[model samples]
Target: MAVSFHSRSNSYPSRQHPQAAHVDEQLTRLRSFEAASSSSICQRFSNLQDLHDSLEKMISLSVTNQVLSQDQIEKLLDGSIKILDLCNIAKDSLSQTKESLKEIQSIVRRKRGDLSAEVKKYLASRKFLKKSFQKVLKSLKTGQNKNNNALAVFGEAETVTIALFETIFSFISGSKACGKWSVVSKMISQSTVTCEAEANEFTIVDLEFQSDKSLKVENVQILEACIQDLEDGIESLSKSLIKYRVSILNI
Candidate 1:
């Protein structure tokens, strides 16, 4: 929304700055991360982090100065800050989810009364997350106007930044990508589980609990590990975002 749009992604001249070319190269690599079937949301965001580092490096060297105006720079800084805010929101949400899961795990281990009540509480928290994600996602829906030219890197970078956050949030929110099944959906699909719930960690565990009156320790452990891995990925993205913001400030 901050940078100008181009009619074509490759509309720049054949003779381009080497530093800008490097940015184009990084963009290609970022795109490839999704093309590979084995790539997860964490992996996709990892590649995105690298791309920002490259963009920062180039911008620091003033390679993109020819194209970036002071106004554009201000927008870039503001955009980075908004993105960082979203990252923090997502991280906090995941932290809450992890803590809730731990609470349920404790309740199950105690073999205490009313385990269903705990699961329902966890599911309720998860339901709140879905609604929040939906609201934030709606606010971020800028139409597809991405460009890949060296002169257009600033615009393109923000596009990727917003796009990846949408993806990371969608994954946590249990929304499907490109109409495909979410990771949570696939994990629970083996059994004929039926529930009026979205495919997400909370719902998956809820179904598991419904199948039997108690939760499985292994499932809880697996989800915990999975959530931890995602948290690590988010931490990495947050660090990169901070560094990128600092780089912009220096400029």
Candidate 2:
């Protein structure tokens, strides 16, 4: 048999070969690490995309809500403007009415003054006439014309009392006229007012209301007083006339 020589292939592998195998094992480990890193990168990208979608939805919702709120605010503002215009109209109307009332009050004062002057003049004339009649009756009572004086005094007294009645009636009619033209009717009609408003968290507003009823009551009291004075004057004059007639007849 030929001498069998131990071939290198049948012996242990060389250091170089083992080194190559170790390199291959390391490359395998590197490839596996690269694959895992790629998977992690893909997961991160998907998460980012989902976040971007959520942000876009939030932005769209915010814009839609903002637009709706703006529309509502515009409608509310329009209503407020209408209310303000109405208030302006009411103010103008009230001003006109006030001017009219002032003119009426001025006319009333002039009439009241004329009536007062008339009453004073009538009272003075009546007083003078009453003195003259009393003097005539006194002279006749001290003389032989007593019966004639009694007749004359009775006639004079009747006339004076009748005149007094007319004056009192005139005063009553004047008081009634005052009541008719008084501000009571105007005051009642202007007192009714209503207003409503809407506001957010940052504003406040005021509505106006007015009244003049106290003025009406004051005028009514003045008219009542005039009536009372007329009644008292009439009663006093009647009593005086009767007493004077009786005295002249007794003499």
Candidate 3:
């Protein structure tokens, strides 16, 4: 969050301004994140936060320099709005899923509630989350292959930003990428993910409910802890997005 105002974009003697150079460095890190051998959902969320934090700094530095024309600013703002929408959806999904998990967990604790009903309720929530992401990820993949060179304003950065969002969303929904965006093709994780092929807390809890129609108390507690971690990550990202959006609006 190294934000400042009113620095001229060309004040630097180097090929790129200091802040802009940082943004490029962050973009490179994020682009290679999905290729890492030990990537996780939490790590993905943290990288996205870093990218936007750098983006905020770079944008603030150029607010008074007119580096981006009116049209470019408008397009950039539109892209920011899309990013915010995706972030909000991720937040909501996590919130709802957490509530469902807590409800089922409560019933298990009481040991007297209608366990069957609660199990079904939680699984239904999971199914709906997956379906929602299906539509979202489909739309995300629409033009993912289009040339980034066609756009001049943060083209590569913007593409990577959306890919990061998609990667997180897919993990939240307990699914795999549709192979359209190869950036996330290496999203294989042994833990801290919700992918069907991966064995994380969420998938373990989901399997217990679907196959046995009950949850072990210890398993419920573990899943709730995992959900809390994800909730914190999503909340942090949502704040970053909203802060960046507000900055652009002021510009």
Ranking by TM-score: 1, 3, 2
lDDT of 2 by residue, 45-157 (tens): 23322322322232233222232222232332332233233223323432433343344345456655443344334334333533543453443333221112212221222
* Best of the two (2, 3) by lDDT: 3
Question: By TM-score, how accurate is candidate 3?
Answer: 0.76
Model 3, 1-251: lDDT tens digits are: 23344423432322166776777677777777762111466677777777777666656664323554454456667777787787778778878988888887777778789888887788788878888988998998764423322223255666877886676666665434322212224434432244334445666566666553334778777766766776677678767767766766656
What's model 2's TM-score? Answer: 0.23
- Can you write out model 1's per-residue Cα lDDT over 70-156, one digit (the tens) per residue? 555677777788788888888889899889888887877787766678777877787788789888888888543344454367667
User: Sorted by lDDT, highest first, which candidate order results?
Assistant: 1, 3, 2
Specify the poorest-scoring 10-residue window by lDDT in model 2. Answer: 200-209
**Which segments of model 3 are wrong by more than 4 Å?**
1-15, 35-39, 63-65, 143-153, 175-197
**What lDDT does the true structure give each of the candidates?**
0.66, 0.30, 0.63
Alpha-carbon RMSD, each predicted model: 6.3, 53.8, 7.8
On lDDT, the leading prediction is 1
